[model samples]
Target: MKAVLFANTDWYLYNFRRSLAMSLRRQGYDVLLISPPGPYGAKLRALGLRWEPLPMARRSLNPLREAALLWHLVRLLRREQPVLVHGFTIKCAVYGSLAARLAGVPARVNAVAGMGYVFTSSQMKARLLRPVVRGLLRLALGGRGARLILQNADDVALFQQAGLVDPQHIRLIRGSGVNCAQFALATRTRSADDERPRVLLACRLLWDKGLDEFVNAIRQLRLQGCSLHALLAGTPDPGNPATVPEATIRGWVAEGLVTWLGHVDDMAGLLASVDVVVLPSYREGLPRTLVEAAACGLPLITTDVPGCREVVTDDVDGLLVPKGNSEALAHAIRRVLEIPGLAQRLGEAARLKARTQFDEHIVIEHTLEVYAELCDPLAAPAESSP
Candidate 1:
């Protein structure tokens, strides 16, 4: 059978869903990948996967352009006549499901990774757009042969309460699944007694990601005269409305608050070097970085919010702090560093959790089961979540 997997960015499709595509091909699937044009499209093609560029914008809200994109997808689906279409993220899910229906496609899988800006942001624009977006979700996701995959239980309940889709149609997958082998506790050790405890926050610099709180936490720790090394990875997302400014990052560096290791290509190497990893994100479908760090056997620190808590249980595998509370975040980091054997204890628990809960092989198998449930177009959509 043939399947079409679509997302807003080629980078997302390549870095995140590449393994799923490859696995499908191995399982006798004619997997066709599509995304907006990006440097990673060629990377996907080089892997012997059939990849094509689609036209769309992440931040565009123009009605005419979005409609045109929807029509284009309808035409493409009609030509390909694929058995299933799986879409990642909000915009792609909404557009892909609508197009698949228009083209008379059988099954549609919509992965709403998070509530996203439309539902989460409190800005005037986001507030105004929520009702329209919510209505679209209801129309696209509640139809025949459609299932919605969410990362955390909180999101699942939110969708159910909102009556966006039937309760039976929701699947709670922990995350994209972390590559345990690629990110593990390999060369991370303290060779010198003088080595500072290094903590990292790696994700696109976005305001709602709690980047502001991360910086403030480090500052508070410094004021307490604690010896620490803070590392910041990933670059500012220019396309995102909540993206932190370059000048602001530079300012943090100037204040000796963090060492900006921008856009790391070797994440495993970096993870193996840091003692602790943190993502004070306000909300997430699930933050990929926390799992990757957990795989690396690093102590995890995150807010006590929905997706964040799914990965770290306050006193069990790792530490959890209150969101938007820099003081509490600072306290957690300090406790991990100052308490003897605490880091090692947390690290061991975190690695074990990663291998058990968020391993890629497990996630892929569960996801493939979802596909299998809907493989037969003539068959009705499965009522139970995978």
Candidate 2:
């Protein structure tokens, strides 16, 4: 069987899908990674996976441009003729799934990683344009022709309720699973001079990621005499409507509450210096940062939302706070700070959870099972009479 994977960025393919791609290749499937070419594109080629560069625009919302993109993908789908076309993210899922269908591709799988700002935010676009998008999604995902792969149950439920997907074809594959071996537990090494606890926030600098809330929480903690040092990684997405403004992030740096490192190349090295990992994102699809952090033996603090909740069991592996609530975020930070022993215990539990529930191997095996059932629908076990 041949499979073509379509996404926006090379970095996403490297960070999230590389292990799965390698596993697929080992299973003797002709797997190819297609995306906009970049430095990470070179890395994909080096890993011996076929890399095809398509002019995929990641940011534009223009109708004409999107139509052009869809036509281009349809042309590629016709030429490649892969057995299955797997699409990720919002744009790729929308355009790729439609294109694959138009080109008469055998099977189309849409992986809804996270709903993204468009669906999660209460912006005017979300209010006015969301229904239009959902109508398009129904056309793209509904019925027996394709399967919609949801990363979290909350999203799956929403899509089902909205009639965007058929319940029979909706499959839940929790977050892109992490490789526990690669992110094995590491010992925290800090010097006496670096006595301050290191708190790290690793995600896109988006307002909906709760950056404003995080900043306010940090400021509140500082005002209340907490001396934790903080670092913010990840890039500011210029095209995203929810992106945190550069000037605002700079102002925070000016006040010295947190240090901003624009785009990080060495996430593991950065994770090494931190005592705690925090992602107070308004919503998520099993955040990869939390899984990686837990694997590295760092305690977690995340919002009590769907995907985030899957990674950290509240009061067990990590602390959870109300989404978008600064007071709740600040209080959680303070609680983690007051109890040093809790960090170690939670970190241990998080490592175990990553190994047991979020391991890459388990995810790959389950995914392959789904593919097998897709290939041989008759061989798949029938549901018990109900």
Question: The CA-based lDDT of model 2 is what?
Answer: 0.84
> What lDDT does each candidate get?
0.90, 0.84
lDDT of 1 at 146: 88
TM-score of every candidate relative to the true structure? 0.96, 0.94
CA lDDT, candidate 2, residue 89: 86
- Candidate RMSDs in order: 3.4, 3.9
Candidate 2 colliding pairs: none
Q: Write the per-residue lDDT of candidate 2 for residues 1-386, one digit (tens) a residue.
A: 68888888888898888888999899888998888777898899899998888876677778898888889888988988777788888778888888988998867777888887678889887778787778788888764657878888888888888878789998888878887776674444676797898888999899878888889999999999999998899888875788888899999999998999989876777887888899998888779899999988788999999899989889899999999899998888888878759888888999999888888888888777667656555323343334
**Model 2 TM-score, all chains together:** 0.94
Query: Which lDDT tens digits does candidate 1 get at residues 87-153?
Result: 9998888999999999988899988888988888989999999999999998889765888999999
List the candidate 2 regions with Cα displacement exceeding 4 Å.
185-187, 377-386
